[model samples]
Target: MSRMNPVLSFISHNRYWFVIIIGGLLVGVIDDNSFLTRAQYALQIKNLKEQISMYNSQYGRDEQKLNELRRNPKAITKIARENYMMKAEDEDIFVLSDDETNNNKENETTE
Candidate 1:
């Protein structure tokens, strides 16, 4: 029999390993639904779950505040006064800012 070339013999010996490496690359990185794509989808799912949990916790806190507002007249009044700046007709609200206070002090000094 004729002697086989060294390159052909080496390729024939490692043919199965070449197929396995090619198959692994296709399944792991080159396929449409690949492992790399699945890992990215998993990360997006994790972030969406975290956002859902945060919104749920915020909803719970808002619900507690609503319940408190509904049950207690003082709490309702406090929310109205602090958020809406509402006051009774008999009460005179003095709204002062730091800038106004500084201007008043400057005017006093000039006088």
Candidate 2:
């Protein structure tokens, strides 16, 4: 064979190492289950777990409130007053806006 080029000689000497490096790159970056994909999957799993815990806590709170509503007449009235702006026939509901409260405080301070 004609004299091999220096580049070819180097590559021939380390062909196995080159193959291993390229293979590692392909597996780590190009495959479907790549390192990056696995990392993203792990992050998604972590987020889902957090959502599950948050929803579980919220469910527990709602369930407790439901039980309280079933057992206590006051709980139903409180929920109605707080959430639905409801009141008894004789009760007065005072709806105070923040701006009104602020103006009142400013007027008091000025006076």
Candidate 3:
């Protein structure tokens, strides 16, 4: 009687299991639309959602500021004076130099 090789006998016995494992690995890792790709896409979608929510909140704040500017002349004037450095006809504007502002920041940080 001839003795069969142990490796060949083991493989024949577990051929189905080997096929299942290889098929699973191919589906999960080697396919174009695999589990890893799906996971990466899900993470990208989550990040995009967070960015969208942040942008929506910023848009809401800008919309509220626009409404306030439209309804109240005082708010418009305040924004112009603070942002554009505009002055009234009889008002004096004391503009701080960039150096002065940087010095003030340094002093505040030191304090």
Candidate 4:
């Protein structure tokens, strides 16, 4: 077999080097343009503003709920009974599971 010349090998591989050169040119353009940077900054600012608006809306709703809870005595008692599970002074609380109750009724009929 004959030996290949270096110039001929390089000419054959020129397409790969051309791709690298073009990729470098594209990176240089993106890095040099202030418009791309400014656009990215504006998008970040808009996202932050949306997050702040959402937080403000949630905060206002929570504040209104807190104020209503403070002003009303019966509402506070109801909330405490439901959330904290506080019972009245003379009431029997029966905890029933829907599945277990149905099974008990079915077995009672069989017996």
Candidate 5:
């Protein structure tokens, strides 16, 4: 009778365990749909949640500004003057160029 090599005998004895472990690893880490791959989806969900929070905060701020504008004529006039270059009939509006604004910012920073 031939004696089996010790390494071969050990491998044969544990073959099922090896297959189960390797198969589990393949399904968990190497498959297209896997727990490891789901980590990316989790990160995407986190980013989307952060964006939703940011948008909600921005919406709240915009809603508050809208309510203020609705209630206050002065706020409406301020927004119009800042955004639309609007002025009263008796007032003169001086529009500053972008270069002038940048230079003013530089001067302020230097000071």
Candidate 6:
């Protein structure tokens, strides 16, 4: 029996716009074709590619080292002696630091 205020009536009648905007935002989030989803996919792909390149470089270095070891018996022996702490029965090994030798020379000169 009473006419509503025009502003209130217009807002009440068009309340669906709020629901439409919220629904559109939700749909965009769920759709992988959206811009944000595409950027995330691209970043993941780039990170995987960088990891692959790093692995390939490390593998290449290891392969080169393996080839060198295969070609040189002396290098293998040196590596074994240095890294594995191997010693020949006939040889006496003394480990000395260059700093100590330098300090000894300096002491001798001062004395």
Candidates' C-alpha lDDT: 0.90, 0.92, 0.91, 0.80, 0.90, 0.84
Clashes (N, CA, C under 3 Å) per candidate: 0, 0, 0, 0, 0, 0
Q: Is candidate 5 or candidate 6 better by lDDT?
A: 5
Per-residue C-alpha lDDT of model 5 across residues 1-111, encoded as one tens digit per residue: 135587788889999999999999999999988997899999999999999999999999999999999899999899989899899899998776666344434556666
Task: lDDT winner between 3 and 4, please give it.
Answer: 3
Candidate 2 to truth, TM: 0.78
Clashing pairs in 6: none
Number of the top-ranking candidate, with lDDT as the measure: 2
- Write one digit per residue (lDDT tens) for candidate 2, span 1-111: 345787799899999999999999999999999999999999999999999999999999999989999999998889899999999999898997766334434556665
lDDT of 1 by residue, 1-111 (tens): 245687778889999999999999999998988999999999999999999999999999999999998899999889889999999989988887766344434556666
* TM-score, one value per model: 0.71, 0.78, 0.74, 0.50, 0.71, 0.58
Clashing residue pairs for model 2:
none
**What residue pairs are clashing in model 1?**
none
> Where does model 1 exceed 4 Å of error?
1-9, 99-111
What would the per-residue lDDT of candidate 4 be over residues 11-66, giving only the tens digit for each residue? 67797787887777676556665567768889999999999999999999999989
For model 2, state the Cα shift of residue 33 in Å: 1.5
Q: What stretches of model 5 exceed 4 Å from their correct place?
A: 1-11, 97-111
Query: Which regions in candidate 2 have their CA more than 4 angstroms from the true location?
Result: 1-4, 100-111
Clashing pairs in 5: none
Error of 6 at 4 (Å): 8.2
Of models 2 and 3, which has the larger lDDT?
A: 2
TM-score, prediction 6: 0.58
* Least well predicted 10-residue stretch by lDDT in candidate 1: 100-109
Which segments of candidate 4 are over 4 A away from where they belong? 1-33, 94-111
lDDT of 6: 0.84
Q: Evaluate residue 76 in candidate 1 and report its C-alpha lDDT on the 0 to 100 scale.
A: 85
